[model samples]
Target: MSTEAKRPPVPSPSPSPAAAQKRKEKGTPGDNGADAARATELAPTTPGVRRELLHSMLLQRRFEERCAEAYALGKIGGFCHLYIGQEAISTGVMSMIRPDDYVITAYRDHGQALARGVNPRSVMAELFGRQDGCSGGKGGSMHIFDAKTNFLGGHGIVGGHVPIAAGVGFAIKYRRGNQVCVCFFGEAAVNIGAFHEALNLASLWDLPVIFIIENNRYGMGTAISRSTANEDVLVRAKGYRMDGESVDGQDVFAVRECMARAVERARKGKRPTLIEMRTYRFMGHSMSDAVSGTYRTKDELEENMKRDPILLLHNRIFEAGELTEGEMHKLDDEAKAIAQDAWDFADASPEPPLEKLYADVYADTSS
Candidate 1:
């Protein structure tokens, strides 16, 4: 992990005896062992699938870039968090899951929503507080919900939704269903009591849930090293007796491979796995903190930007001869066009009607 020159190195907690033994038997998380190779079979490596993944990441980048512009123009309101550099994690993981699977994420969720097949236009409309939004404009930015796509919704509270994810997994197990539930939250959420509780139950009950920590290194404005004792978060899984792994979030293929293994474990064995994705967020915690305020230095940001997820994948696919440079440029252009259309749609969409305030808030228990 790259830290500012002034910061001290963060210490890692020693894993328990059992956990150490398991690590010895299975090797480290990022090792390209038999499990890693098996993960490849879980996801298609066809050129077409590769192109789709790249396009998804590009579309998310363009969409978030446009969202930033809209927020500056006062077209969007509320706490808007852009998933700029963490696109690869969402695009890669969502690619390996089935439509019947469940996905729940934190406030930085536009990327996951789009990756889960939620319409970009509806997502933009939600940001614009328009009637056509997935959440009917009421859940602007932070609470994008779409039941049709099995995207439970983006929770506003930090670590509050962790237990909810466990509940979803419980429901699946109760039904004797093979579906898996993937919960995404920031690294800071690991500190929350509910996060630990959820993981414990998910393991004890043998729930099919994959807990993914988007360790962007910063909990809002504070860096993970400053906030927590151990920056190596994967070790937390030892307490719950669940499998844990770490992945390079910037590499889409690596993200996909790690998720494939987790998904397989969840679907096949009704197991839970905790994944710590070491990624960086190019933007601030929200629109309020532009390019990250005083917590981090400009030079540090620049250094991290060199590993821009989209650019990394672009170079890889180009070198593999799966896509031409010209074709990649065209795909980027297409992504931009899609984002443009979403913006236009949001601009033309009407605000929520006064009657809609009471629409979904109350349940019709009389029925």
Candidate 2:
């Protein structure tokens, strides 16, 4: 067994009155929608808000697209998971979180790392195994970390980061702080022992954690239905005795609203909540998988593409008279320029020094 799988589960903390109130409020009809709409409205009225979301999503899309190109060119090594179509989940959720909150996700995490404010150049350099890369290039594609931004890490093991997220929440609560931890995992992880163990601990102790399950319907090549008896990922939360719901992951508005509620609840010291985001992956599971695999039909991919989060948000902004087509194009151009600059920065940045390798591995025992 891997070290992650062998790690013992952490115990849950005591419940808070604020968390209980939040749960009671969630039961009210239209509460979730009202909150979501408010979030959409609260989103900065300046053109930059939409532009920023769009730019961030586009940067993620293009960055990964470039990763695919680099993988073919042998510029990047090791396992690479592309977040081609799942940009909205990270961007929308991160928007609702304060900088103090923590973010932890599974190996498919390049996008989450970027959305959490990690520099694209550093992330790319990490992928290139450069010493200056995030994690000192030791983590590579699966282990990006930025303590400054509160992004705990990109855990390579499936379902491995759950307990760590719980620990962060525990720390926040122990210190009498309001910070929340957002744990992102795939639907496949729902069936894992770690998922259940972490959820149970969070609920029983009222830890301030938001469990986000990005249900893209596939765990690697296996579909959700094939691996688990229950296809409704959110329903699993009930077993933990916590509030859980499914949302349209591709819809930025929907995700924003859900995250707001979750974050607010966590901030108030409420027990954890489970959210299953029903999204899809535009590309294969990773750079290694064939684009046209027998596991998934192209028609399915085409159908999901129709609900592209970027296009949906852009059209909504235009329809609401908030932006013009030219403005949208201009935003796209800016995003392209930023992505190019990030790539250039990564390419120009010096690799980590060889001596640095033995530096951060462990604390100094001699002292």
Candidate 3:
């Protein structure tokens, strides 16, 4: 879908309120906001940066492919969802955020967690149900969490994390912080009550949050068209009086551009924006589901594969003179190596001990 319609007014890349106030009090243009805006304009990304973007996407692709293999081999167990074809969305959005900002997502979260800088070893370890895992192996595939990175979690309950994301945004606002919370969920979650409640509060409270709908065409076994009354999820944002737009998630550049504008709006205190990313998943909803199941035919899966996000970025970078095909292949090999290293680490890590079952289950409330 084209991102040309219902676009919000892009805010100038001005400093955050706190930064502007600080500069005003200091009686100086701290770091020169104009120059910052020029750099912030998303001018065709530098070739080096583009290469890095491609590399990140390649890493995610290889990582998830290895995850599938691990799942098949019984190395990874319990509710594993692979982000095979939706790499661009995570890489693009994550590229635009700061380290201090918050990120939360639904079950299909390996890509987002990795993009948010969660270490691959910990992630793979979590999938392997080992002690050194991010969530200490108890959370399994759907509960990847890293507080150090401010990555809230890979929530298992559909739409459950929406309200939690709102709480994070509220905390930022209450603390007078400039951080934005990017909340991601599948198209199915939009129908849930919590998703709507969160959006309404995010808009009404003026919370800095970007609600991203990864519309991969299917929610479990049902097509989104069959599940929702209106296939266009962007329209729902209007009811909450929030900015809404659609982007082609297959193209990393497009995702980055759209997210940049949204980030700017959030930083400028414009509150929430709902973005629908039109993408597809090459694999099943989980490792248990068939790639081309009864709900979707083989032809549809093959057709969508042609627009694979990683390959799209690969060709784009090549056409833009950023990296040659040979260099791309080398990067892919490096990504594979990284994934392999993560697997080896996870395989060697010990499983959580019996005593670990009681840890983190309850907080010390007596204090």
The whole-model lDDT of each prediction reads 0.84, 0.77, 0.83
User: Using TM-score as the measure, what is the rank order of every candidate, best first?
Assistant: 1, 3, 2
Rank by lDDT (best first)? 1, 3, 2
What is the lDDT for 98 in model 3? 96
In candidate 2, position 77 carries an lDDT of: 84
For the record, the alpha-carbon RMSD of candidate 1 to the native fold, in angstroms, is 9.2
Model 1 TM-score is 0.89
Evaluation by lDDT, superior candidate among 1 and 3: 1
* Cα lDDT tens digits for candidate 3, 302-349: 777766776655654554456655676688788879988999999999
- Show model 2 residue runs off by greater than 4 Å: 1-48, 365-367
Worst 10 residues of 2 by lDDT: 6-15
- What TM-score does each of the candidates earn? 0.89, 0.86, 0.88
Q: Give one digit per residue, the lDDT tens place, for model 1 in 280-307.
A: 8888888888574499888888767656
lDDT of 2 by residue, 170-207 (tens): 89889989888999999999888888889989998899
